[model samples]
Target chain A: MAQQHLEPTDPTAGAPPKLSTAVEQGGPPTGDALAGYLRAQATEFLRALRLHRETGTASSVEESVDAARALRRSARRISGSLHTFRPLLDADWSEEMRPELAWLSGTLGLEHACEARLDRLLLALHRLSGSTPFPAQSLTSDSAGSGPPAPVTPERGNLTVGAAKAGALLERQLTLARTRAHSTALQALGSSRFHAVADKVAVLASEVPLTPAAPTTDLRALAAAAEDRLLAAAAALPLVTAGHPYNAEALVHGLSPDPAPHPQDGPWHQVRLLLRLHRYAREVLYGGGAPVDVRLLAAGQALNRHRDASEAAAAAASAARTPRIAPATAYALGVLHADQRHEVEAARFAFQQAWQKQTVGTP
Target chain B: MAQQHLEPTDPTAGAPPKLSTAVEQGGPPTGDALAGYLRAQATEFLRALRLHRETGTASSVEESVDAARALRRSARRISGSLHTFRPLLDADWSEEMRPELAWLSGTLGLEHACEARLDRLLLALHRLSGSTPFPAQSLTSDSAGSGPPAPVTPERGNLTVGAAKAGALLERQLTLARTRAHSTALQALGSSRFHAVADKVAVLASEVPLTPAAPTTDLRALAAAAEDRLLAAAAALPLVTAGHPYNAEALVHGLSPDPAPHPQDGPWHQVRLLLRLHRYAREVLYGGGAPVDVRLLAAGQALNRHRDASEAAAAAASAARTPRIAPATAYALGVLHADQRHEVEAARFAFQQAWQKQTVGTP
Candidate 1:
């Protein structure tokens, strides 16, 4: 069978020695190997969870953020692996763990997401407003000066008038949102639900429940299936739109007043989800000690940027809709919104380039 | 008739005294009034043409740009008026003058367009690249320093690497295009064809070639027809798409390798053309000395920005396609292209706002 080609003939040469030993002595690359991989991930998640709790108020903010990030990363890997390798594990146990893991990841991630978005938007606003010297003041002063009057382009002058005000409004709104998210994250971390999840992860660190059929199941085929799903999801994205450096039509969808997630973002997010599963499945196949795939890392970073930029644009759009704002303020928000959307396009372009490079290099 | 309502009941009150005198004494507001209007426009064109020639090398670059702009403006008004009120003018003469006038306007405007695009793109690049402090140097120095290390976001660090190089490439390409356009304008000005057009305008300053039926044609009905066309075209625009602060789909059309004008831009250019005709036709209706309509002027300014930004984005996309440049440079160009599209969206938003205000105020 084609799947047999993926099996390691010299077992130690492919998977880590521990997993190879488990496969050889345990009779097959089945639930035994899968459980070993799951146990290792669970142990790592427990370590991160402990580090997160131990950091407490004594640690610097950066250290706390780092701990939370580490905790979330482990949770994501565990959850994603469970999802992709479900057939090899106890279905009810794995299914029950997935949502708890997801909740923990999402709860821990909100503050960081908010902070990154604010940073992205503030940077964009500074860049956009910085170049256009407010011409109103310059024009008036030029009229009063003894030197030959400078030529003022009326169009550039008018567009930049509200940039400062717009920046202030955005800073205020995003900062407030970030504070709220921070509190929410803190609350969630201390909740009984978080404790329950931590308790389950502690148990998982010692024991992994697996199905009886898992011992004979072909791990390679399942990993391949995970990769296939990721590829299919990616292929379905509006890559043609993403390939364009400027996507004006994408911006139109962003302008809608509905507060729900943007429809255009759904497919990209799905691809991101699938990509994580594929990455984690590969981790299991390699027995969790494989050298990093630089191309996959780059693609992940690009997708993360795509997500950040998309959210930031939506935030800017929401801020622009504030009641009774000055026209200049609204105009500035509009410009800022466009700037974030450009970042979205830029991120998508970066992803396309990185992905294309990977395909060319690998194939 | 519905057309009669557009006609002046008290001619002396609606039109300038000179046109009313021509209408009253010459029997009907026919070829005589139309010819008088044409003759006045021709006189302005002749004056502008003379000033353009007289300014020569002694003029400041600003003065030269101003003179060229003046010459183009008069040429556009004359050509547009000829198009709108064709029935009142000699068909053969009008048809021949129109293209020559268009040629003069386009040739003279090329250098200005290039310069404006360069200014726009350079400003955008400067803004985009200015915010993120170069992390590479900071990162190394931080490791050496005793102070706590700053958190460096990986995504922002990677995307900005090629910005300066991209800016330099754009500057070189646009500057070269501008120099070529400047020389082209100079060559066109000195050509025999320009002299022929100038001589024709000199003749037109004294007498306009009127069709035999011009004497009885209703000027009001013709101007109204021009307005109708403008209104219909405006109504046909995808205002909902334009209304959005960000339009991603619009950006897709921009990314096509085909160098022809973007399909999305065609409708906008058509509207701009019709707007000019309507504006000039109104100028004729008011006998040329009417106060400027602020709303029309605002809408025109917005459309001009829309055109400028759309073209600048195209220029950036073209620059990005230059062979085998660094990935960083391509990324920077992509960001720049997206920035210009944002500017395009902003301009569309501005037009929507101005046009909406006009409708509300007038109604």
Candidate 2:
């Protein structure tokens, strides 16, 4: 029922003569629909790519952030669509394009990630430094209405010199690092690998690689297969236990010696990706005509969160290792490290719980 | 230089000699030393367990948190030591016990994560609900000292009815979930699974199953080998890229064709664990006489952060999926999810940067 509710519903069902309605309703995906979808995504990708090239070098950070975000989204849409509809397209061509698309996305994501970290760390440090230990007013207030106010707990100068120094170190290093990454991304974009991919995609709008007179294919099977693969992968993963979930040896010990080998944590992350594609496929094909699976959407969304948290914690650890810095700075870094690590743990626990619920009773 | 600095340094080089120092100066691991280390960890593990049993059921949440923290730490130490010193024990027995420990840790971690999420979500909502759109003072007043003050940006009421309902739903569900998990953990601690583990560990402290006349082995070599395995595994992992890093197919494509294959994300995490064990081994064998690999420590520490972030993001996502709730609450949940996801991205970027630096010129 949850899955059905989440499926795309055709709000315009049985509407009088609309071009979009004819292709989307009560039928498998035809070559025309696949081609149309690919073209739209390709066009959007190029548009974003061009905008990025134009504004990526701008002095304004916000501009670059916006450009990068747009580029990533469009690129993702193009890539996802290509994979989902590949059965109807030239397999070799689709395969060739996937890697290039991936490289572009990775390059952009790297810079954006750095910029985001810098902003987060800086904001946190600023708040920490700005906070004062005690209020200016005396503890013994003579206000009639307010009963002897609870003892104003003094803010014990929480921001140590080490903390401030650590904050400064983070700012300096993260800023430099982000700038470097951004430039690297820009360079990559300008490289032949990127240009070749871009040029290919630019031409794809007018000429999609659909097979000649391809029959309509039921996308539901593809989507189900994707889901099944993800489920199987998850089942094989060493289930999270009470001890250190990150401990590899313990996980290795738990691995089933079945022919279908259980993958490591990395592949599990891949499962998250497949889950997303499956959800997107459902959305694109069903397009409000069919009910979506909420559980799948939820699972995909949760996996995204898991991946994000895992990466962030790694970044924070890097930040913590600012090196040869003052004791104050080191202390601050430690605090940051601890905070980030806690967040990582929280995310893992949440995923396990969510995944367990999602998989229950689904043979 | 930071890595070098983090390496272990001998503290008592010129100090008076102790009986323990005789066996630790550059030789293979002796059975007695292995026995001693295992015993110490077992003692710590049991002590923590008793404390947990005593305090876990307390009315005060803080007490339970503290006890759980202690139990987790001791359990981790025991588990780590076992993995590092497995050769000194019966292989089958060590393998059998590892899973039970993992189960215990995972259970406790679940409760802790839920509690943390509930606290975080509630605090965020409080802050959001507390903020007003505008200042109370007259905007027309032109104070001489203040002089052309920058206009204050209005805080648009971002909290919709859907957001509030979502927050409440999260609070209620997360709170209930945490309580249920806490009780479950407590129950588990008293369960047969737990008792069996405890009884096994108790027997382990007194009698270690070391190989007959096992020659003293160079622990450094063992540690290095461990690190190498981790690195190899990391190398095999399809490097997390921008495009479809979440996609399972892309990741699988990156898998090596060799029989002794390395995993991607999973191996990187394993590297963190091996690094920790190596550091601990150094601490135990050298007794502050040998310096630690600062780079290794830093790398491990960063990995820990990565793991934490990954887990936390998953938790935040679970929180966001407060189903069948108010639309306003749903909106709030969405906002929370986005913010947390951004944090996750930031962390991943940081880790990549750190890892690149940490692994320069080393295959």
Candidate 3:
């Protein structure tokens, strides 16, 4: 029952194994095994996170980003393990994953890139012009130096920077191609894929593994089960909405819907169900949580970490001569200042609003 | 012998007239059934000559352009049918194959863009360079005409020209991906997929108007037979390549191996033995002839077509003044001219020399 309420796998429990896992596994193992393992895990991580996003249960960008970061961290750990695996292989394995993953990740990276660049561009353009606002100053001085475009820049970059504003149409062509391809692929994976994979994992967990197993089932079985659940979940997702499809190459397993309900009952019902199913099966086999959440509760602690981050940022800002930053940060700092001596007690309504609008939406 | 050759329910026979077949038949289609119907056939029109190439099988720049033309034709057919599917869907009837075919055709289009761009880039760049044979006077004048560093003839416009070069990369990527994903998926729906599907189709076809009657059989028995064949074929593939150890997705459906072979081999054989078994199966599938040789013959035809294309270009070049073209095209034209043709008269001698070299290990 304790397992029934939580994420089964407790993904946070993995924690990239803290670099120590690599140190501990500590082997100049054969190249074949290492490379294969690394490739498999990294690919799996991307697939899993892509699935998470497609579920669309998260209400905010922060939650989405948190999920992405968790997946990325797992992938990195998997990649780190590859360091050991690479030396074992007869041929370079990096190129193999790069081309394949790039086909998918390159597109996701493009979105990230656009977000980063747009943010930077906004930052550059938005700084106070000796003291005036945008468009008033966005126009070039047409002479020696152009004053800052806007008196007070917006906290983030504007989406209005079309190809003309960026540069010649020619310059933007390749970037557009690269970005569109990535964005399309990423969006597809996220919108419906999460449900698909969850569905798939659930199926495999319910079924008995074919191979002779010492630990009940092997890594292959685990992966196959996960893939099964994910694909099934993706398949069940309503296409009229968003997310990955039932038949994309990455999650190629046949989708079969779960006969049971998901655990947690979060935004993603399919994911909840499949995860629950897998957890149950895994527990039956290995005595772990039924429908394991895999360390997701660790993420619940992120709110605490965010508090620390806020304090650190406030201290740094207080020390700086230019205490004023963007309005967003200013607002954030204001909240931090009010937190002193529990001085923010009167803001219960505000806290509720923030939790509903921001925290729930984010991590 | 006929039973061995003919899939009991001939897919090409069209939907049977009335609901008789489905009432007699029962259940959904299997993977085996789906594959049996989709295998491409060779007819006398296509079989007149099966020319094969010795090396890489990728389509060239020109051939890819032609494929675009066919794709456009197919695209038109699909879009025209969309109205047919859309209206039917509104009527609560699923127009399954048409939509899927449409998507397949649409993805084929992305390949065309790559081809056209490659061709255009090559064309434009050639035009930028004067007519192929140089007028020595203009060459000198052009070299001396760099009056200003930035304008008139700057290479800025040419930077994006690399887009043409990237076209091949795009095409190659598409071919590799789509081929691995859909082609394999389609082919994987073999006797097992099809037999499963055949039951469904038999029912559906019987319900749908204007189709032939499905042959009678117990679906379970047929499905079991299909599974036997499916496993047999899937077993022939190397499920765990040294690098890709756990992906059963491709093998599970019998997509990895040549379909012409005895695709009934299950997952029991060692990868090496399975490969040999597939070859033997193919020979059995096609009386005494190897698919390897058939593919080779087809390639030779493509190469001959290319050779013919080059010959045509050379003849045109000989008849006309040097063309204004990209230096690349001029280079390509030169290459076309240099195509070493193996004439019928000396081919005998060349073969003897090659045979001798192989036997004696000559340089």
Candidate 4:
């Protein structure tokens, strides 16, 4: 049955396509196009799941990582598309499948997130403490003749006594966490719950249950609404503070002892969610084959950085809370936390630049 | 006349060596010990000043930079010692010489400070944006066979589009400022005021004018008072906040738009000044020939870093205020600002660690 649906000349393709065409041109609607979009995404997800399972033991670590990443991406797109275009899909099936897909995507993503966060913090520690020559000599006319200008070695930083200890502490804590996360992810992949999700996706690859009202729904309008939601959330962000080189208030707020997520981060996270839905809606409207929009890609990338930095800061903060640690270690962790927060601000600034430059409907 | 004082067995050394010995011992009054200490510091200053002048054009940039550093160090030591030991010296002479030494030190140090600051900010930007692999793979037993685990390439940071531009802006501004400082230092060195200061230092190399009460003054009590001042200032600092991994209040306080120096910073700065005086008093008590105290040196270095980080943060904030700049650039500068502020906190943490470990009068 899946092979039959995969054929180019399937009977469902004969219906007047409403979702994939311009909204202004009115035509007789059918559920075929929406079903086709969902089926294609589901098929890709199933393929990725198969590859991920295959690579678990047989392939190099990079290949395995890639497979997991692909699976997560496909799952996210399927889940997000279902969310933004929910009215046209069968209410119970779509609602049930959405959370499963979300769980799968999030579980699969934890290892990568942990790895990326550790990379960010260690790199920051090295740069902060390492001996790098000043690059400012380029401004001097005599710089060319002087070989390379001598490094401006400040009297005291030649040996940041705490840096090595701090790095070790961070490595020990984060590596332990990553190992635990890795095992959890592996267990999840081999579990009955995962098999159940895979089984559903396989069924979805050939059949998409749709509401009776699906045939008449205007997907363009729903997609436009997703874009509008993203825009509104972004507009509400503290853009002025983001533009300012230093947002002391945000920094102070981040320092609160409360273990909950930062309040200021909520709006940006909301924008990131809305953006994914908007991007996935576009994919559905274009029958999942349109050339990727460069601006949307840039904006999406920026938001992704925002999320990574926010998570990394949280990790640093957690590491700092380790009891009875050396004051030097705590100090290094503090610096690391601040570094990631700065990165958060930078990512927001990048998003503002990319999002503002975007023209609606151009893609 | 200066040659007589340069001799080891000069008339001043023949008196009961009161100031240079343990403060608990009672001894007959004499101004010779204090006079000898001042002359030795002055002689070193003169030598450094001469080296700085000679190295201005004939030496490599490194030599020139080193000469300036040496000159500034000597000038600072002399100026600080004079301030702390004011009662033993001719009031008029000490008062007049202190400001001249400060001016010379400030002018000479400006270029290097700018270079170090630029280095700090640029390094921070690169670390925040650069692609480095995750260091967490060490935790896994299988990591050795993976030919170095692949960099946990987070989807969006591969191209931090703003980093390059932000680095360029910082370089341009800081390099220009350094050049201006270099020229200003050179001009000041050649000015009549500097020449007058130099002539006075040269005369000081031969003779130090002493007050009538110098012979009776207890140098030990005065030096102890300087140490007391340093300890008092340190006690007033927010050590608890410094020890915490995240100092949100300090970070927020730093973000005030007011151009005045941060209020929290003022106490640290005061402590730095007191630390210097305390250190120089020890130098005087030892007749400037004692082995360096490792703990005191460590504490001093930490305070120096505190000063540098505070100034670097200020510079980043100033650059962010550049009118009509791109939001991305401002964001980068903002990140740089936060990075430096974290450094300031880290320095304070280091200072607390080092200072708390000191046993008074042990050195």
Candidate 5:
């Protein structure tokens, strides 16, 4: 019952459990255990925020408004919390996180407003049904199809003889939403964690009409495949001998990207937070007046990359089993050049560990 | 069960029930029946827009974000639906019933945000209580007493992860709320809603002391007394001669002395809507970053005015019982003066209605 302070000597003191082990075995990121914790927490916050907007039991007129504020506020907190990693970010990367997150929060506000309206309509239907001396569906159908344009009329409910209200130009708001899209897309370009995935997914997200292409699959499966690939890539990144994602800060700072958020040090934790924001904003604008199936598009692209990775993983697995292509053979043949030359000891160790696991179950 | 259409022959027909009838009857407002029906439906659309914030929830992270967006879309639609009142506002006021309401939908949006935030916090509290290895009271205590420092260590439950967000300005927001306060002095100087009744309520409200002069009776009883007074004033407004709450719009529109919601024409719906908004905004801003006790404030204010108005109403009632104060008592003396004022017939009718209602029972 005590408010225990787990500042240092905690399970998360050094690094997160799964990721730390993955890195120790030489197949995933290591060292920034604190960063990982921060990232995970950010993700968790975003997830919990959804409950407010997603739960049912039709919100009251007052609640609808409150719900929208809650969504915006939680998002702001999550995005702000991401800023804690500024010292950890290399350079320009940390600077771009806030604006993107802010934009994302703004988009969330819009989205919350939408769902609340639908719920309100449902409530209205319930009320109208009760007041009318008729079945609910009859009144609904009558309102929707047969009677005057009910949606456009204002004096139709009890307890709502509200004063006149001004109407905003939807097209203006829509345009504003669209203008922000490119900013999100550009942010994805510099992100090693999500860009690679988003890029590959974007390809698959498109139409395959009468043209010769792989037959389209249902979204649910596509989404699952995409997730599988992303996680796999994440697991494999530390093992890859490229050492590329590490130098991300150098290239970004040298280039002095136009969308820089912080000038000196920051925008660290913001990178991942902003990506989520990018995802959030894109979804809101697309769902509005525009009919864009962004989710499927991302899924398709992920599937393609997933297929490629699976093939490589399979080949590597088969070769590992052949005595002729074992480590001794690879060392003699000099095919382990990457391990020796690029200092890919961690990755090599990972493969050896996998083989050991295959022979003797993990301790 | 049939969806009724407007009877073509009766499009502009039907003896419109008085305004108070709408409140008493509770189905829809009585008016140009068609206009009233349409306006009420539009109001539903607006109310629903605010509720969509609930859809922001999804079991998964992305799903939740998507849900949030869905809610915002609903809000936008709800706001857009108010445009139908534009033409109505432009209609001739030769047959104007009361002050036209304005800026109501925007007010609703503001209210929706407040409600969403409160509910989100409440839900988080619920989740924290339900989620763990210990007593809820401890968490509640910690939740209140812990210091994360402004904008730095924002915690949601026991999980405190620094995200570097930019929402440190909640206190600043609270200050902004103060700026929007509908101070009694301002209302008294400008609005003509119920100055005489409000004058009495003002004495009571002021007694709470910007600095607390002294302790008083129970807040609940005080609030009740205030509410009763407002109810009486609400009843008397229509009947009291020379009561110009109806035509004070000229000043609100820069033509007269009062600051009503502008114009003595069209629909008076937005007026009540905006009044509710002022109440809501005040509630959220002043009531401890929450909306607690706002309704009580309104009720108390109403009760105070109700008490002030009842004195006149009682005298009127006594005259009817005794059949004495014909054209001589303060009752008839005021009535004679009222008979020569603007809207004499309307005032007389309202008085008779109030008298008839009092005969049966006081509101």
Candidate 6:
């Protein structure tokens, strides 16, 4: 199919409805306006997806990371905009496109994570293995439920042995994983599933399906509902509860049996995504004129920290559990895991602090 | 109170109850054995904690990361063992120590994550800004939901300008956050909350509370129940269901809304914690005898990927929204966000594949 281009029209260009359009003969031309915005996003998404495919084969890490990042951002925008503007678009088309976009972006996201992790673990190893006075007093002072603190000698040789082993174990495993992820990403890019999405997007760049009755769609109401849905979800999180420690166990046990831990258990994680969508919807509507909600932004940022810290801790724990590693390496990894866990606590603390400080209301 | 040391006796040295023990003159010596094990873990935790304290003031990132990791691992072991053997120990004591251990580990976890993130975003900037062919065709071929792919020229100037801006924004914000976290951690270490726990642990090194009825505590039953609880929790995960993608939205929306999304919302995140507890239980019971469950291990690893990818995507998105940055930087951040989100997608895909391939049973 011949690829067509949509003009990069401003998404917020259409004037706000003069009144509740329910009384209008057929409502204002908001459907076309929404479609115009959707098309612009679709166009940008296709452009970035194309960039990803082109650079997917590159051997250079930098090239792949950049390209993948572009593709992911575009996919999110398209998906978020589709959901936000779904009322004005063909229901079938929106449903079909959302999952496919999700699939494509997810593929790229994994590859990027592998690359970043490899980078992080390796750098940690380098720093760890470097000659520095091993802080002998650290373990003793910070020791918790163990026996009395072991004496730390100011010897680099003793400390480096364990740290190096841990580093080596992590490097081997992460490198292997990164290679696998890189290959998977390449294969997915070449797959028919990907190609099919590309074809659809290329078509969407020019032609967007609009319901005949869409002009009458109340965007303000839709926006309000979306915001309300997000707020409702966020409010429902265990983090919003009094006396909660923002840990997994507390959240899980807090639920009533049945579906207790699966769906409701993830309020902290789920809220971030909702916040993303919420922020995007506001951006689409408010454009440059309105200031973004500080609370929403802060909550998202704090949650982002929470997620990052927790994931890092998990990763560190995984490394520490590597079977049959040298004792020294095991020791090093133990330290790494504890450090990452501390970060998780800090992030949670930060989130709690923010939540407590903020007035309970919409941003 | 003067600190005392519990003898590190074999936890299993005390025989399993010779009889139902209800009629025994005095309960068997099981409480002492259990306390012995608890003391061992406590000692290890304190040792690591000391190492962390000693190294906390180190300017070397590597030293701090390593020390923090050790503190975290020891804390986890202590926390896990405490829960596993809570029936044999003082309930109030165990309850109090678990949260405090959690706090200490959490503090270190946050510090490590901030340091890691700052390192990652800065490195990404450096690479993105470096001169290369730019792998310009990436988006064109991968373009999915938009219009015709934009052409990429090999020109380095256009891409680098925007990338550098994005990189700068991330560097500045992440550095600030890292600095703040470091200070917070330091403050926490010196706070009464931390010192109080330390003093308690120091005292516990020598003495432990045993419930009067503890001698007859059935450990084997406790282990079985703990395992069952973990299995039940794991089974509750949406991943256990066939054809579930690992996205937060799908999982949330999958629920019919009666039970809501709380239970199903957190499989990818919540399951990891349960798995950690289960693994620890096994390690405690089996020691070096039984091999780790390969399926459980693999699931844990896959879930780790899902988490890392998703978190990275969120971080990227946050970066993309950097306020008052140059347009070029914003463009770069857009690419980075897209890339991270794609990684998230890829990890979820990998997880679904793994879950499907595994036999339907507790790993």
Best by lDDT: 1
lDDT for B52 (candidate 6): 70
* Fraction of native A-B contacts kept, per candidate: 0.01, 0.00, 0.00, 0.02, 0.00, 0.00
Task: Tell me the chain A TM-score of model 3.
Answer: 0.31
Chain A only TM-scores, each candidate in turn = 0.81, 0.71, 0.31, 0.82, 0.25, 0.72
Order the candidate numbers by lDDT, best to worst.
Answer: 1, 4, 6, 2, 3, 5
- The lDDT for every candidate, in the order shown, is 0.66, 0.51, 0.28, 0.65, 0.27, 0.53
DockQ of all models, two decimals each: 0.03, 0.01, 0.00, 0.02, 0.01, 0.01
Model 5 — TM-score against the truth? 0.19
Question: What is the iRMSD in Å for candidate 4?
Answer: 15.9
RMSD of 6: 24.9
Using all chains and alpha carbons, the TM-scores for the candidates as numbered come to 0.50, 0.41, 0.21, 0.49, 0.19, 0.41
**Native contact fraction (fnat) of model 6:** 0.00
**TM-score (C-alpha, index-matched) for candidate 2:** 0.41
By summed lDDT, the worst window of 10 consecutive residues in model 3 chain A runs over A250-259
List runs of model 2 lying over 4 Å from the truth.
A1-25, A53-64, A120-159, A237-268, A287-298, A356-363, B1-363
lDDT, candidate 2, at A330: 32
lDDT of 3 by residue, B176-264 (tens): 55455434433433336433433433443323221122222212333233334534553343433311211112112111112121122
lDDT of 4 by residue, B221-281 (tens): 7777888888888888888777543443345533332434456788889888898888777
Report the C-alpha displacement of residue B153, candidate 3, in angstroms. 5.1
Best by TM-score: 1
The C-alpha stretches of model 3 lying farther than 4 A from their native spots are A1-19, A25-51, A68-87, A90-96, A135-182, A187-363, B1-150, B153-363
Query: What is candidate 4's CAPRI-style docking category based on DockQ?
Result: incorrect
Model 4 stretches astray by more than 4 angstroms: A1-31, A131-159, B1-363
Q: Give the lowest summed-lDDT range of ten residues in model 5 chain A.
A: A158-167
Query: Could you give the candidate ranking by TM-score, starting with the highest?
Result: 1, 4, 2, 6, 3, 5
Model 6 TM-score?
A: 0.41
